[model samples]
Target: MQFMKFRKIFSVALAGALLLTSTSLFGEGNVADAAVISSIPNTTRTLKSYDNSFLSVTGYASLSGGVKDRSSYVGTSYYRTVKTSREFLQALLDAKSGSVKVIEIAANLNLGWKELNLSSTEIQKYNFVAKYEDPTNGYTNPTLQANGVSKINVSDTNGLTIFSTSGSTIKHAELKLQSSANDIVIRNLNFDEMWQWDDVGNHKEVGWTFIKVNGANNVWIDHCKFAIGADGMVDIENGSSGLTFSWCKFGLEANTNPASDSAIYKSITYMEQKYTSNQLASTSLYYKMRKAGATPNQIMAYSAYHSKCHLVGSGDKDYVNYVDSNGKDYKDGNQRLRITLAYNQYSNVGQRVPMIRQGVGHMINCYIDDTTHMNLENSVSSFKANSTSLARGMNARNGASIAADTCVYNGVTEPIVGTELQGQDTSNMDPQWANLFKNAYNRNLIVNSQVTNANGTYTGSSWDNNGVNLFTKGFVWYNKSTLNKWAWSSSIVGAANMSKTKPPTTPFTFQYNYTEKLPYSYNAVPLNDVVQTVKQYSGASKVTLSAKDWLKTVYSTSSTPTTGSSVNVGSYYRIKNVNSGKYLSAPTDASGTKLVQTADKTQATSLWRIVAGDTGYVNLVAQVGSASKVIDIPGASTDNGVQLQIWGGTAGADWQQFKLKDNGDGTFGILTMISGGTQGLDVNAKSTAEGASVIQYNYAASANQKWVFEFVK
Candidate 1:
C-alpha cells in the first residue's frame, strides 16, 4: 500500500558506516565530495615553500625592495626582510593589485602586528593564519577588528590562544576585507594562556578576556581544546550562522605539576604585581591566587553564559554539567544561551539571536536545565528541553514572548493564549520533576512514577500517552524534531515492567510493520533471521467449507478446562478430491462457479452457493459480470447469516459483487467502485478495512456491492 507524504528523508551521510553494524539505520552522506565542478578558464598555479620568508602576504610578489613581474614561483623564507606590522599591511595592499591567488608559508615564522594600522571602525574580511613550529608561544595576536571576515582556520601544535595587550578585553578580531563571503575553520589548536589577571590597586576585576566574534556567520571550532585560565571562551554572537562547535573540548582545567610550580608561580605573581601596580583590585587577586603552586586559577566555570557555549560531539555534556565554584550547578537560560530562532530557511537560525537589540532573537533546540533564566523580549523563539531526567527552569516571567517551548517545567506560569503545553497526564504514569532532575536519566522516569508536587499532579505512562492527559500536566515529548537531531540506538532492547504474561516472553524481535495481532495460524515474528513455515490454502476455490472446520487432532489437548467450559460444535472436512456430482466444474471466467443457497435456509444464508454444475451454467447467480463476486453458502439452518465473496474479482464481474456491507456496528462504509475496467475491484472510498473497496454508486447502497475481504488460512 502507498503511504502518506509525511515520510522522512532517508539519512545518507553515515549509511555505509551504520549498515556495517546494523540493518535499521540510514544516514545522509557528504554532498560536497560528490559534487562536480566544470571548467573555468583561469591560470592555475601550485605552491611550495622554503625556510624563512621576509616577503609580505599582501597582493604582489616582492623580494626585499624590488618588485618581481613574474606570475608565480616557489621561493624561500629569506625572500624579503623581517619587518614591522606596517610593512605587512603595505605588502598586502600591493598583493591585491596583482590578483594573487594563494599564499603558503613554511617553517619558523613570527607575524608582528604591533604596528599594524587596523581600525576599530571598518569591517575587515581577511582569511590568513601563520603556522608555528612550536604549538606553544605561537601567534600572539587574538585581537582583530570585526571585519566581515567569514572564515578563519587556525592550527598550532600546542593550543590556539589569543590575549589582548590593550587594557580592554579582546572583543573582536581585526582583519582586512578580501571577500565578504568567507567561512572560518580553526582546527588542531587550543586556546591556551589566552587570559590574564589584573590586580592593580584596590579595585579587583577578572583578567583580560577574549570575546570572540560578536556576530560572525558560520563559525566552526573543531578538534580544539581550551586550557584553564581564559576569562572568556569563544563568544559567538552578532548573528553567527551555522555555528557548529564539534569535537572541541572547552572548560578543561590545567593540570597541576610540581615541576612547573616555580615557573607558574613566578608568572602568576608577576601578573598580580603588575596589575596591582596598574591599580587593579587586591580582592580579585586574592580570589584568583587562592590556590598556591602550579594549580591554575579558576578561570572557566559553569555560568549562565560560560556553560552554554555551542557544542557538538563528545563535548555536549561538558558545557552543561561542569561543576561551579560553589559546587552548585548552573545552566544558561533563554537569553544567556540562545540558539537563533529558526525560520523555515536554515539560515534563519542565526537571526534568532542576532547581536543587535530589537533584532530577531529566535533560539531553538536549547536545554534550559536548572539555572537557565528565560527573558525573551521583543522577539519570540522556540526552546526545546530534551533532558529526560532534568527539570529545566523556564523562568519566562521576565516578559519574554516564547512562541513554542517544549519539555520545559517553568514558563509563563499560567497557559497563554494560542499556546500549547503537553505532558500533564495523571493516568498510569507519574510525571514528576525530581525523577527527571538528574543527569543521564531516562524520560521514562516521569512516565513510570507519580509525583505529588505543589504545582499539581501528573499521571501517565510511557511515550504512548497523548491528548489532554499529556498536554495539561507538563511537557509534550518525543517529537519528530528531537528525533531528527539526536541519535537513537537502533539495537535498543530492553524489557518492560508491565507483566510477563501480558507482553509475551523475551527474545522479542523488532518488526517494522504495524502493531497488531496476526491472523489465525500465523504467529508474530520479530525482525530477526529466524523463520517458520506453514501451509497456505486457496480461499477462492469452489470446494470451500463453512466455519465449522474441526481440528483433525489436537497437538496437546487437555480435557480439563482452565477457567472456561468447552462445548463441541459440528464440524466438516474437505474431501481429498472433489467428485463431479458433489462439486461444480470451476470456471476460468471472472465469476468462477456460482452455487445457490438451499431453499430451506434463510435468504441471508442461502442467497448463493457453489455446488456441482455444468460449465457456463452457474447454480446461483446475482451480480452478472461484476467484480467482488458474492455467494450465499449455507451453514446450519439457523446460522444462515454467513455471506462470503470471491477475492479474484474485477469491475463489472457478476460473481464478484456485494452491497451495503455493514460491519455490524454501522460506523463505516466500504464503497467499491469499478473504474472502467473488468479486472481487480477499485475501492472508490473506504474509511476502514484494509484493502477493502470503498466505491461510489449511482443508486442506493445494496448487499450485492459491499463485501469484506477476509483471508482464511
Candidate 2:
C-alpha cells in the first residue's frame, strides 16, 4: 500500500512553431533552422533543430572551424567540407576547455583508425580479453596481435557534448566513456560497424559497444541511430546514474551476420533446461558448491559447459555490480543506477532490448518490433526443440527494477513467435538479486497482436500474461494493485504512436559518395520527430513542464480516481456510513456478530476485502482472524430492516452478495442481494450516533443508505 503511493510528478508540452533562416550545402537550402527548447526545470528537456545552436555556446565550436585545423586533415575529394573520423576523435580527447565543450560533427566520418591500436599490456589493463577460447567454435580469445582495436576513451571529462551536425553520421567506432565522466551529452549520431573479425572471420567481441557508459553520471544519449555492431548498440552499466536514452533507434543492418544455428540451438537448449526442467540447477548448484568450499576454477568449468552460454549482441553484464566500498553486498537501500529509457525504437536486433541488471530503469513509450533469432538457418528447427516458444525482448535480471510503461512489443511472425518479457531471479546467490519489480510501478505491457502458429493458425492460447509472469516469478507481487494495473493497461491500443518520422532530404548529402552498392544502408529518421513522439507518450507527459504550468492543470495526487466507483478486486477498504460517521466493524475471532457501526479504528477488524462476485456484485469479507468470513444476512432475510452479521461460510450466497452502485459523488450505495436487490444496506433508523446498527432496508437514496469506501492497507 505504501508503494502504491508513488506517482509521477512531471509533465511536458509542445512549444509553438518558430521561423528560422536555412543554410545551404552544395546548392541545397531552405531547411528549418530555428531551434525549439522545451524547458522542464530540474527535469529532462528536449532541444530540436538542425544546427547545434540550441545547445550551450560556451566552450563550443563547429568541427570545421575553431575546434580543429581543417586544412591539415585530408578530407574526402567528393565532400571536402566533411571532417575525417580521426580528426573528430583527436579534437574530442584533446579538448581541455575546463568547461562544457561541444563539438558538432560535420560529415559521415569513417572511424577506422589503425594508428591508435592498443598494446597487449594496455589490452589486458582494460580486461578486454575472453578468458577461455573454444577451438571448434569460432570463439577465439582476444590477443593484441590477432585483433584490431580502435576506441576513443572519454576519461575524466565533465560537461562535454559530441552531437552530430544535422544529417551526419559517425560510422565504425566505439565511444567509450571512462569512469568519472559526468554531465556528458551525445546525441544525433549514427554509429555503424564498430566491429572486428578474427582469423577465421568470426566477429571479435572486444570494442563492439557503440556507446559504453562506464561509471558515469548525468549522461544523455538521445536521437541517435545504432546498427550493425558486433555487440550492444548502447550499454550503460558500472554505477551510471541519471542517464537518459530518448528517441533513439537501435535497428539491424541490411546484411548483418546472423547467429550461428548450431550455437543458438545449443544455447536455447541450455536455457530451457536450466529454467524449466532443472530449475536453474547450474547457477544454484554452483553457488551451493561454492558455499561448500569449491574452488573458483571448478565452478567456472561447470558453468562453462553446463550453464547457458552468453549470447553476443544481447546486453551483457560485465560492468554491473552490486557491491559497496567495503566489498559488502548491496541491499534494497543501496543507491541504484537510475536510468530512463524513453521513446526509443528497436527493430530486428538480437535479445536484451535491453538486458537489464541492478538498476532502476524507467522504460516508457518504447516500440520494440521484429525481434527474431539471428540464426535463421536453424531458427525454426531450434525453436521447435524447446517446449515453449522463444521471442526476443526485454530481459531483466539481478534484482533490476524496471517500470515498463506504454511499451509496444511486436513479435516476429516467422519461425516462432517469442515471448515479449523474459526474467529470472538470481537474488539468492547475492542479496542484491532480491526482487526484480520491487520498485516497479504503473507497468503496462502491450502486445501489438495475438501470437499465432507459424502457418497463421491461432494457437488457442495467448502471451498476454507473459509480462506478469516475468516480473512476479520467484517473488511476491509487492503492491497488489500492480497486477490490477497490468490487467487494465495491457492492450494493443497504442501502435500509431510508434510511426516513423520523415527526415529532411533536400539539404542533406552523403559525405562518402558511393557508386558500388554496399551490404547495408542506414534507415535515417528525423531527430525532431523522434523527440516529439517520445514527449507525447512518456511518463513525464502526464504533468505540465513548469510549476506555473502544472498549477494551471487540475492534477490529482491521489492514485484512485475521485469519480470512479469501480473497485480494484484485491484492494483493502474501510466502509463508513454517512449518517453514523463510523465504520462497519466486526468482532475478533467470532463466527458471527451483528455488524455494528463503531468509531473508526486502525485495527484489523475495521478492514474488509472487496471480493469480486458474479454479475458485478461483491462480497465484503472482514479482515479479522484470517479475514475469510463474509458479511451475511442471517436466515437469508428478504424482509426490510433485517440486521447484518458476519458469517464464516460459502461466499456468493444471496445473503453474502451486495451490488455497490456509484452515487457519482465519491460515495456508493450498497444494494443487498435479498429480495432481488430491492433493499439497500442502511444505518438503523437513520441514526447519526456512533453505535448505529446496519440493516437491509428498502432503498430511499437517503444519507443512511450511502457509504464511502476509503482505501487502506
lDDT of 1 by residue, 583-627 (tens): 111122243242321212212222222221111112222222331
TM-score of each: 0.25, 0.39
* True-structure lDDT of candidate 2: 0.44
lDDT of each: 0.22, 0.44
Give the clash count for each candidate: 111, 5
